[model samples]
Target chain A: MIHIRRDVCGYCGACVSVCPRGALELIDAYLTVDETLCKSKCKICSTVCPLGAIELEEQ
Target chain B: MKEAYDVLVVGGGPGGALAAKAAAEQGLSVLLVEKRPAIGAPVRCAEGIGKEALAEFIEPDPKWIAADLDKAVLIGPDGTKFTIGNNHSGGKVGYVLDRKVFDRELVWQAAEAGAEIQVHARASAPIMIDGKVSGAVIHQHGKTYEVRAKVVIAADGVESKFAKWAGINTTVPLTELETCAQYIVNDIDIDERANLFYISYTDAPWGYIWVFPKGHRCANVGIGIAGTKSGEGHRAKDYLDRFVAREFPNGKITELIVGGVSVCKPLECTVADNLIIVGDAARLSDPITGGGIYNAMYTGKLAGEVAAAALKKGDTSKMALMVYDTTWREGPLGHALARNYAVKESFIKMDDAKFNSIIHSMSDLSLDEITVKSLVIAIFKANPWLALELPRLLMTL
Candidate 1:
């Protein structure tokens, strides 16, 4: 699963653009991840976050 | 909102604003929607642009100008400083913009030209008909509207979803992406008229820190690292905080902005059936400087002009809108982007020693403006041996 630290997320939508599965969405300043579509091992979003807001949690 | 319009523009950044302005000036019914409640609040940019490039779009205004820069200072990884002043940089350098006010000014101009403007309006999905984008479903202040248009322009900045929703692949490669963090720091002692850039692999790997004066005792202190180098402990903010602590310990941070910049090539094709993509959405940001304000405005104007022409002819197909794609690719903007991307590719691979040597060699040399040709010539002059290894890169430019 993907864990997003709301406090750290800048809501810049960097993660949404790089998500291969289109699992992330940035509605205004709020960023939401559809976990059903998120792949925990991918970690692509976590890697691209400027603030290190997104993290991968082992299921 | 009207059920239909001659043009629909999504994301009210410079690109969308310019597009809306151009199309509406042509007597087309234009509608521009911005997702944010305000036009340019929470600016996600370093707000620096070449003066000449900006003049091509709008006249220089003191209302939005933060600082008029006549010089640029570059610090090597070893802290050796190289200055490029008016003599080396050409008399007109650039300006550090107050993007918050600047963006609103642009949108206001679009409104003046008869483009219907809507803020706090989000386009949730592309209204597709037979795989062709006709318009979008917009949610504005708790109300939804299925707006249709003869042509749709996607000007959504980075984190572009409009084009992706329309079946265009707009994903930026992780390696080519730049994760960035910035703070508007006040009460810092700074050279108010010069833009300073700090390059350090130890501090910011494959990226650099910038101090662009926002006038007086304030500046936008920022850092960007290659996305591949970003992680838990070494995030862009981590490097920026470290730099700020050492350089401006007493500086007060007033605002923090974090975003991603795509330092990759422009999208494969910036147009599809009934749709056109512009600005950061088209990946037109410079690969070397990571600057996009000029590129966005330039391409946005072109998108609007092309869309207006296509709409007049009653052919808004992929073929008709292809002119927008071709015109930009064949222009000076295209040439600059190509050359800069090549330089970025070469520079990203260099070690700190190479950077130190290059800066050391050019510390006293008088160069003719900042361009790929001039930079390559400088490198050749400093190290004749490097010429043998640069031919392949030169060929691309």
Candidate 2:
């Protein structure tokens, strides 16, 4: 259940820095979910995005 | 080591060094500490000081000044602009300094007045005895030692955490914060006579972009955006990077610095038993402009004197330290800061069109005539809609 939209986002990469699951990387200044390292164990990454730009993997 | 002193100043930056200088000048025993191995290594500031601030606090030494400026250019959100000159003093409309040498000059003044200083001595926690500040626990060369003192003045900069240990509320709300990222670049074209303040409502939000020229050749180009508007840490920096790429497609990126600015009111209380807070620690930073080097030095001097007086009376109570607050509020630095907060809150509401109109109205003013408030007034005059929005803006700030 990821929930990020690229158009309105500022590309600050706060999610990339705070991601515990190593699920994100900066792509053109916005976050790009790296499926290889992502674990849906917790949704902390989605919750901390200030712009509400984070998307989650489905449960 | 149970070494005792009359006053202990922490952090070797501008405020700390000046506080130590002021205390030493007043004939007090003082010990100043810097965590770094050298006095002014790893520079972090844009190095712009107004003339009004410098003259009132410390005299300029030729050894540290890089250039003397007499003009400023305020570029509005929509690219409309104006310049001002000959209207301020102390780090005023002039002087891009060599901050490393400048910082050393201040500390040197304290040493000239006989204050003991220790470099490479990193102060950790404040030493409290029965609710009284005794001194501090310091770390250096991989070992911890204790130094006891009658009073301590906290002149640590914006990212300070020392006040929390002493029980002072030092948190600054995000809306009043500015996230800045700057690159000191060479081969950039600029007026040697004018300091640039570039702004935009959508881009910087509550803050503005600054391109301060170091000389005729290089400049410190940076952007400051309201931290809360991004609603996320680091977004402001990313915006700065984008802004840079879009504007200076060919300029080489040299040095980069990322930091935050506090444009909020100073804390209600900056003093505690045997403890006095000065400069960035107390949020004396101008809410609108995000400048605090002057306030830091001014408060540093006062804190030094107040600490000495408190010890003279054998009373190290927080009440004695309150004198510093009273001293500052009655003076130019505090009064100017108070007036600035009101003006800063108003400008934060302006959009790009509003900004352009304001700048368009004042395209002919000299450096002496340009001011943050005057520009807001122009915006209100051109668009009565802006005039009606003042009340809401006041409340938000």
Candidate 3:
């Protein structure tokens, strides 16, 4: 699962654009991730996030 | 509900605001919509604008100015630095604006000109009528409304899909796009002036890094990299983080901005029947510097004027709106953008060694002789081997 540090997120949507699974959406300036659709092992969004807001947790 | 307007503008950035203002000033009922709750939150720019260019639009309001910069320092890959004082005529002098205030002011100006302003309103797609843009379907406050207009102005920024929705090809090649990441850092030691650091293909890839000082102990530190070089394992934020660590170790980041800049030439066609695209949607930003405020205002004003005239003339066809394209491309702003794009293409191909040599050669010339032609001449004089490439580069200019 991915953890989003809401305090650090700038809500710029850079992560949302790079998400391969379309699991991220920015609604009303808040970034929401759909865990159901998000690829568990993939860390593309976490890597591309400028502020290091998105983190992947160990299973 | 107000379901109709003379000109419907999508996006509330400077471009859209100015377009709405201009159209409204001509007695056209205009409505400008912005997706954000506020006009300029989450600023995605480095906030630098050329002094002379900005002067043409409005006087510098202290309310929106972070710093009045009069010099630019260029640092080469080898730590060689050349400083250019903005006191010289024709040199670049500019200001780092408080974009939050600046953008809102423009929107306020639009409202003052009689244009209705709507925040939190996102345009989903163009309202098409027989293959022509009639207006747009907007989603705002959990409800959708079909708004009709005589003309539509798409001033939406880099991620604009309105142009595509209207059947214009706004696709930018990856090589021509620059992915950017910026941080507004506080508690950093910086000169009152700004610095542009060029590091060949290592630190920033094709694009460069900018440290624009805003005020005391605060600045905008950012990096832009060619999109083609920024996928897979590498990203612009990675480069930016490394640069920030190396330069401002104690700096605390107050804001983070990530966005894409289209560094290609302006679209050959910026108009369709009942539709005109301006700003980033039209790719009117400078290809070399990634600065779009002035260009956006210029094109937006022109689009507004042309749209108003077309409405008055009772013809909103593609042929009628083409006057906007012709006038923009033929003006000084268009010519400068085109020239800058050519210079950028030639500059990107030069390696670090070539860039160092060019900077060394440029140091010998006076500020007056630092024109585009002189720079090319200096390059040729330093490396006579590049004579073959010089012609091709010059042809682009």
Candidate 4:
């Protein structure tokens, strides 16, 4: 699962744009990730987040 | 129960607020809606604006200003620094704004002028009747409501969909869109003034790195790259991260802002029967600087005034609203944006050596002699080969 730190996310929607799978959406000024659509082993969101808000968990 | 408004302004940024204020001041019932929980939260801008441009809207209040900039330093690709004093009238002098305070204040001003404001209201789509926009469907707190208005001012930002829903073409080519990433960093060593560093075709291809100072040793450091150069292996964040690590190694980033800016010419049509688009949705941002705050508010005021006039005449037809487009394009703002777009196109094609030479030539000229005409002359004088493209460039202005 990918973890999103709501406390730090600025909700600028950068991750949503860069997500190749269209798995992220900004809902009510918060970044909401759709796990089913998120590509496994994809680090693009975590890498591109300016606040480092998105983190990947170890299986 | 639902009520109809004279004008419904969407997206409560500077443009939306100003439009609402202008309409309400004319005694027209106006409503301004913002999707955010609070206005100006989750800032997506570099927050810099020219003093003169801002003066045309409202007097500067200390409550919204972060730093008053007196100079702008430009760094060439070869690491040569050229400093320009902000002494020129109607240009150069600027301020880094606290957008949270600034945006909220604009909305407050609109409310004070008698415009109703609603936060957490998201405009889902336009309500069209017989191919004409009559109002919009808004979603708030998991409930949907249809709001009717005689005129709808689309002040939505870059990712705007209202214009498209209204049957207006708002497609932007990838080449004209800028992918941007920024960080609000603290404990950084920077001059009190702002600086724009350009390293053409490298590090930030077709874009530049900006460091806008905020007081208390804090600054907004950011990078923007041409959209065409940003995918498949190149990322704007990678470039921004590298620059931040090298320049502000000891700095702590407090916030991250990511967004896109359209740097194309204004859309062919910004108005269509009872609907007008202002601000970024209208693609009013400067092509070279990616600055839209000043233009957004300027055009927003015009749209509001025009919409009011159309209402007074009891005509909200597309023909009546065409005046807004004409006034904006023929005004100083339009001329400036068009000219800057030309400069941006030409500047993006130059190699590092060409950029260095141009900067070298500019370094010798006094700021007073650095007008657009003179700058063109300087470029031609530095590298005569560019003279062939002068006519095409001049025509854009």
lDDT of 4 by residue, B172-253 (tens): 5666777788999999778876545555578788888889998778999998887667653466777889888988999999
Worst 10 residues of 2 chain B by lDDT: B365-374
For residues B127-179, write the lDDT of model 3, one tens digit per residue.
99999999999989999999999999999877666887677777666667777
TM-score, each model? Answer: 0.97, 0.82, 0.87, 0.87
Question: Which of 1 and 4 is the better model by TM-score?
Answer: 1
DockQ of each: 0.81, 0.06, 0.19, 0.18
- TM-score of model 2 relative to the true fold? 0.82
What TM-score against the true chain A does chain A of each candidate get?
0.92, 0.72, 0.92, 0.91
C-alpha displacement of B91 in model 3, angstroms?
10
Alpha-carbon runs more than 4 Å astray in model 2: A1-59, B86-92, B231-234, B364-367, B370-387, B391-397
Model 1, B1-397: lDDT tens digits are 8999999999899999999999999999999999989999778999999888999999999999999888888899999987776554544888999999999999999999999999999999999999999999999989999999989999999989899989889988888888999999999999998899997788889888999999999999999899889888888998999999999999999999988889999999999999999999999999989999999999998989999999889899999999999889988988888888988887787788988988888887865465546666676788765667777675764
| Candidate 1 steric clashes | 0
Candidate 3 positional error at B283, Å = 1.1
lDDT of model 3 at position B138? 90
lDDT of each candidate versus the true structure: 0.89, 0.72, 0.81, 0.81
